[model samples]
Target chain A: MTRIDYTDLVGGLGLVLTGAAVSYVSISQYPLGTLQRMGPGMFPAILGVLLAGLGVLLSLQALRRPGSRPDIRIFSPLFVLGGIAAFALVIVPFGLVPAILAITVISSLAELRVQPVSLALLTLALCLMAPLVFVVGLGLPISLVRWPF
Target chain B: MEFLANIGLGFSVALSLTNIFYCFLGAFLGTLVGVIPGLGVLAAISMLFPLTFHLEPTTALIMLAGIWYGTTYGGSTASILLNLPGTPANAVTCLDGYPMARQGRGGVALFMTTVASFFGASFGIVLLTLFTPVIADYALRFGSAEYFALMLMGLVAASTISEGSAVKGLSMVVLGIIIGLVGMDSQSATVRFSFGVMGLLEGVSLIALAMGVFGVAEIIMSVRRVRTADIDPETLRLKAIKPSRDEMRRSWFPMLRGASIGSFFGTLPGTGPSIAAFLSYAIEKRVSRTPERFGNGAIEGIMGPESANNAADQTAFIPTLSLGVPGSATMALMLGVLMIHGVAPGPNLISSQPELFWGLIMSFWVGNLILLLLNIPLIGVWVRMLTIPYHILYPAVLMFICIGAYTSGFTVLNVWMVLVFGALGYAMRIFGFPGAPLLLGFVLGPLMEEHFRRAMVLSRGEFLTFFERPISAVIMALTGMILIWSVWSAEIIRRRRAARAAGDGATTHEAREG
Candidate 1:
């Protein structure tokens, strides 16, 4: 297997540069030491350094030697991804019911099975129970439908 | 004597019928996930966090604690049986555990791990009783610099101990830090990587990230073939796998050693149980008379690491409860829960809120008792979960992850973030990068940012104040050393491997002459 850690090395180095840029930007806004005790820029600047420093170390390690790189397989299919995407796409449009049904369908596909009846019933139960219990029961208002509701 | 009193107090609250039922439910759920390969307690906790929105704070908390420890016990079962660990902490168990299974000693390994978790958890319960008040108070004195330094040290340790190349591990940590930087800027309240997305304003939910990276990534990894391992029906016979008298004798010291190391390390900010397990495994191997016996079904190896892992898991709660700083992501979420309830956790909690404090402290004991009962009797039930086809189980898990991530903020955008992270996580894994550090960063990032701002406010922007504070200075110094030491160790390993290769070539030539 080809050494795969090198990719992360490159990615890490890129992050360091980005972190430096972010820190620099944060420093300018807060004037480095503007707040005496707890300042806005202080934490971001320090954290930025920590982030970059970690990236640098990782990059060096990756450079030193290459090890086994397993061929990456897309873990979940486009269907599973699509399931999540559907949840996001339809969440506000169709409401939690449609969104949840998408999630359950794609998820059950992990077995790669489309147990339609079970999926439908599961979706129905959750869609009703979720809003009713979390929103109505708790009195935290949520729309049964999205924007239209 | 006080141990008994504290334990009695704990039982009073834990034994409350309501609390007990929740505790059982939490433990059962925790164990179920623990048995599922790739679904971990860390993600599980985040997934379950929303479900507790309706429960009373105390009941919710006690149940969460049950799940936390319960998962540890559950993970050991998977490692011993299938070689696939249920939780990250159970990785150490895989060293000897898988070998034991291959040798048909799976039952023995399972039994030993159970006893170890029981004792180790008990030890942590004792430590929590005696030391929580004092430690919590001492934690109150930690300043901003100290906290930042502490987070840095943890990141370093996590990177150092992570499986595979240390460099890749460090890279993962950096990646996590960057991910953490997403959302609203702590000091300025400015939108960051959210890219003007309203869902991004709340920052990336930890649940989404965790589910994406761990939950979804794992499902992708197993897509090639369902990882269905063979189960020997004979292995289920309890009598088939009892530890021999000699094996039992050997296990005692390692368990104690594990417990001790776990307690000590658990007190530190970043050195959580997972690290403690690795450290204990190394120490146990070094001290053993026959070190070569490890990684080959050695009971001592499993016992020592498994016990220490649980001990560390339990005692880690001390810092979070007493002092406001949580040692891990789950604890951080717990902190959020506490804050949500209008409770500020600090040193004076034990005295100021005795019922809440003592009640929780005491509940640990009851939780441990419940864990043992459920873990043993239902071991078969958990074991049976392993045989359920992954195709059936994983989808439900995916459902849980999706719903859980969305429920983190009741937002749709967060679901997308989870998917993106799941891809990134899978890529990182194939690339040999570690994910645990990302979690550490997520857990600590917000807090580090908050403290940095506070410290500046207090110090009037004088950067030198961080160094001036003795506690903070020492912490930063230690972090610096860890970074340096990890680099040095990696270099040495590289050099040694190179030298050994050359030596083998030379020796081969000499052998030809002989």
Candidate 2:
């Protein structure tokens, strides 16, 4: 007997749910005209149904064999994604310099060992270099430093 | 002859001071990123894409194309030295190249691969020059039916031929198509999955999607994983790069064979340099008289794949330029760049924009020559770059991704989109679903729907019109065969594994009875 692969099962179920939701929304919200003249929703509705069918097939296939489990790491994604979020939050309000410093400090924490002096130095260099390259050289419209208040 | 005139036109444009300067800058940056172990060509291109907005369309394309082909040359340096591919296309090189490095022939490997790359690029460029006009002339006769059929074949082939579960790949393509539908319905002027968000009216930005998936997601995965490799400085010296006459003689035939194979695959839709490199390496191993020496520092192994990838990189432009259908995700991004510049790529592109066509081809020649000159003397500088730690690198890369995403739309919303897609991309990677097919689908989805709707209207709702057309029928038949073959082969492999397991179980039972 084959072992149940939970990863495959969950992934397939997620696909099926997404497909079903898309199909439902497409059919209900928009018009599906005749084959000669397709409405806006016609292509998406067909695609959603096909996706659901494929998802069913995938789930069935998983029952016949085992599949590899995903290798999940928390540290890298947490800090890396966190850093991007921080930059997005800081950029408009605090300007380019603070945004650069924000992302650099946050993302550098993903490394196992964080050197304080080097981190500060790296942030300082980026604050100087990013503006020169992006603002002065490329002439992007963003400001170097701003106060929204 | 007209060919000579065209060549003259190409050289005139390519040799301009501004164009030459941009080409050299592109080659230099391409090598810089390609020599670094963690950075990839796609990430580098997307990060620098915003800078191109300020330049003319022709210059932008010339620079990007330079980067595309230049990376193939620089990738082998790291493969030979550290057994880590600088880009995915060079992964095959590490097998034989690392062994050669251990034997103190690293310099020779680098020199030969560079020469082989130039030769392969020249071969592919010659083919591109000869065949592009012919293919474009033929494509000019195609209608909406023919186009829809061809795009369908491209989507099917791209998803199925990739190295993973065919179902998962197909599902990802479908998901991308749905994502492509999120803006407005162009035909009917109806709002779609936008859900009243103002930003959704213009649809998802391709630059944001590309940078999020290829740039940020990659950084997330590679942050803690990659380590700097220690190098032996003596192996990279200029004096150590000279190869024996025997090694030179043995490599010529393999380079020819590899270039031929690479050209063939490169012209096909839904395949690119990585597949070409792998296939050529396998072919070289099979045709060798002393196959046992393959993994033990064989020069042919490194020569064949390196040559194959460079050739593929050059020829991949054939279909994209002639048919307006990209073979891979990177090609799709290039197409996006052209579209953003208000240039539509299709059959008339060669006739209408002769300068862009010929000039780009001539620049390939110039770019390859520049790479050949740059890579040899810059070996010491590149090796020193290997010592830069991952912690510092990832942070800087992250900063670029943020700035790039922001400038693409000049909105913080685009940055948020990058984060959302970055998380989606990372999750998809963990689930064993390939991202390239999804990208191809996103690029082609809207175009495919437009063609499909047009074809339907032309046929008066008769589904049999697809079968009635000669070209469409043939392509549709090929797509069907590939689908059936993939499913049948997967089933056969599964049953064979089960039988082997059952055989083992029976033998153990019989032994216990005895």
Candidate 3:
């Protein structure tokens, strides 16, 4: 009995779907002229088809071998990505200091245990450092604080 | 005399106070990141890339190149003391380096690796000096067909030679090509996969993509498992670093051999320091009289791979600087830096921007010397850095990534792209796809398309044009061979695994009957 690698199975399916979607959009929307004067769609259409073929091959291959299960965690991605998202959302509206604070507080929660005092200290330190380093030292035009009312 | 004149010009540019300061700063930062586990050269370079936007093109490149090779010098530090490879290229060093550390010879391992790295880098730099001009001259004659075939070979070799499923790797390359198509088509002005977003018109930001895949995703993966190293401070003292005469004797030949191997691989498109290091270790083990001493702290083990990786780091510039074709993702990023600075990289770049070319090469010498100084007496600082908790490190790194991405274009949109790609990268990691090939493909995608389209147009739609030109024919043949060989070897490995499993099962059944 051969074990199916769920990772490969899922990845292959994802590739196949993406490839199909890309190819469909490229073919439908753009003009793929003859090879001599190749249009915008020609290269992508070819690449998309090639990708679909490879994905099908990968899916078939996954069933032929026993695979190890990878240890997948949700806690890290949820917080880390959430932190970046928060920073992005806040950087424009709130400003650099608030954005840094939002990211620092949110991302620190990714760790299994967090020390409240250190997290606060880190946030404070970053609020000072980011402005000094990115704004004053590098002269980027980011505002330290802004009220978007 | 002309060569000497060129060397003198290189020194003039490299010795300028501003360039020297930036070079040192780049080396110092590079070593800092390389010594810290979980930070990679790619991430560090990408993080600092925005800072270069303000500088002269030559100065910008000198600093980035310093970081590029400087990581090789510092990567082995953690490998020796903590048994953690600071960069993937240094992973082979841990087999012997860690054991040597456990035996209180950590200083010797660290000192010798630095020496080997310096020697290897010098050897590579010499080759770069001699070969780049000649290669660039030869490359000036290349047409669209030759360029297209060569890029195809690079893409194929990069994906196939990397660890894990070649199919998965190749798929990632194609996916990158798709991602690269997000911007407007250059030839026809036709907008691509932009999905109606205004930012997408400029295509995905390279800095955002690099930070997402290499920086943010790395933090996500390593946040849980990164550990602090417990070091004996005594092992880092200057007196403890001197290797015995016999140990030094054994290491010299291995370093020489390793540098030779590394330099050869470095010039090849798609191969880089990690492959070079692994190969050097394998060769050293095979050639040694006592192969069993490998995992038990043989000096040759550390010397060979350390020299190999560093040498490979230096020589990897040859293809990039001469042919405008990068061998690896890091080289691709360097190329991207050049393109961003509005300096087109190709054969003419060497002649047109001789100062940038020669100055960068010469700066490698200064940077390596600086790294030697930093890694030796300043070793204590890096060791202390190892003790910083992951809790503190991850947040700061996350902030840097966000800030770096945002600064690349002064857009909040790039930061959001970081999050999106971070999720995508994390997912790819779980599914066994490598990020390097995707990056290499992404950087090369547009260039490859241009050359390919041009070639087809020139050949009047003849599909056989790629195989017609002598240089392109040879390159295309090699690409085909690599594809077939990778598939064949994969089949062979699968069969061997199956046979071993069957054998194990049969043995268990016999034991049960007995």
Candidate 4:
């Protein structure tokens, strides 16, 4: 029954602060004249202002209206959060193929009660087929595969 | 006449065993994705984009197009069964289809959606075949200022359709523009947003950005949703999977109407199926005899939107193929594919590559036929997908995203961006803002900037040149009118609601209070 809408407000405010921060840093590095002639920073600064304005509007709307009640956060529940962190980590070591399979297996383990046997099988098949199709078949030039010795 | 001759050659090309197989594969997967909720052709296309590199260019384009149309049919299936729309367009179908499903007429709903989708797609393709040449020829006359104005209109129309406040949509558009600005300046070749990162020199790869923003983000969101849900799974019992004669007769008119509505929007640069579906729903409701039966369960709810959604899917290709402007993300990807194939999709394409153009049109018909044939039998298969617990699926989806991204370039930057954007996407979803406008903005941002800088250069920094050209002026005027029109409509809704609230008093307040 509790409908605080605090998350909405916080999100909006966070976006505004981030936009402001991006703008302040960019502007300090350059100048208004840098944006005057539609230079490198001009558009970004304008966008920053627009984002901040929208964020303010969103926060105001949240203040006036309540939203759905969310459940208590349960430590990111799924193994996918761990999968997420490792998603970027694996790309370099295992190469794109192994990295992706690890990501899929780990991420699925977090949310679903996946059978490790089936998941491993599916991942291995995909790992083999995807790179074959992309890197070998299509000549994508990704550094994921090597010819068997 | 030459074009006609080439159409003959295109048939020869498209009829090849290789093309036929790829086309079938595309449509089959497309329908599969459409039936399964949370994953649509967008994710499928991204995951599969790299694979296209291995095939013949024409074959790749053919497959991608099949998936695009195929996804629309799948959306209808999910809408009819679980009341979960596989695509945003199918949301309208949930109104009537779900009720019919509850009434054990799920077969009728599915049958009606299939027929209607076929009809709508045919209409859209007919329009595409007829109008593209004339439109592209006219579009060729467009200067930089006009191109700038045109891209501007597309961004505006896309943002205006955002689910929440227009301001938030605009914010997303601006964010997209900033991201697009990250590479070397379009005019000056000066590095911006790079921050001296060596990998950023070539700018962000299209595959990376797309996979990150769409593919990875989707998995993250789906993961969160699956983890959070506590509901027991329903043992679905669909009695029949075919339509009654009466249901078919009743649905025909709405199908025609939706197709007509769909193609009109599809031909435009900015409008897409999200708008088409809702418009069809509204039209059907207004035209229905007992509007009271609408949300409860009505065939028009399924028929109208289903037809229009499919129509929009096919015809959205018109602008991308003819005018070199994409109206949606899928179209943009297809456009990118076209470019990769050494075929720039613009005014010249229809003339230069008649087989490519006509052949694609022919394949659409083939693809739609495939969808009609495939959807009914596959319902059981897609329904089984619901039993596919989250534990096993998200990782597979994530792996595809990473592989697709990394395939574009051998850099780790692609993976990093996907994670970053995935988080951003996750946050945005919770805030009630729609993702479509952001995608539209990102796709169009670079094109718009290139046009703008070109215009400025041509006119020696005279921004007024935008209004000087008649085409540019008309486009800008249309954009302004749309912005004003949406705002006025929102205001009207606000006032009407206020008046209704005052009249109904405390009794109505408690029932629907959020």
Each prediction's DockQ against the real complex: 0.41, 0.69, 0.76, 0.37
Ranking by DockQ: 3, 2, 1, 4
Query: Please, what are the lDDT tens digits per residue for candidate 1 over residues B250-306?
Result: 999999999999988877765778888888899999999999999998998999888
Best by lDDT: 3
Q: What TM-score do all the candidates reach, one by one?
A: 0.84, 0.96, 0.98, 0.87
Best by TM-score: 3
Candidate 2 structure quality by residue, lDDT tens digits, B142-255: 988898888888888888875678899889888887887789888899989988888888788887888777788888889878998888989889999999999999999889
Candidate 2's TM-score: 0.96
- Evaluated on the second chain alone, the candidates' TM-scores are 0.87, 0.96, 0.97, 0.91
Candidates 2 and 4 compared: the better one by TM-score is 2
**Worst ten in a row by lDDT for model 1 chain B:** B505-514
Off by over 4 Å in 3: B506-514
DockQ of 2: 0.69
What is the Cα-based TM-score of model 4?
0.87
What overall lDDT goes with each candidate model?
0.74, 0.87, 0.91, 0.73
TM-score of chain A of each: 0.67, 0.91, 0.96, 0.73
How far is B336's C-alpha from truth in model 3 (Å)? 0.5
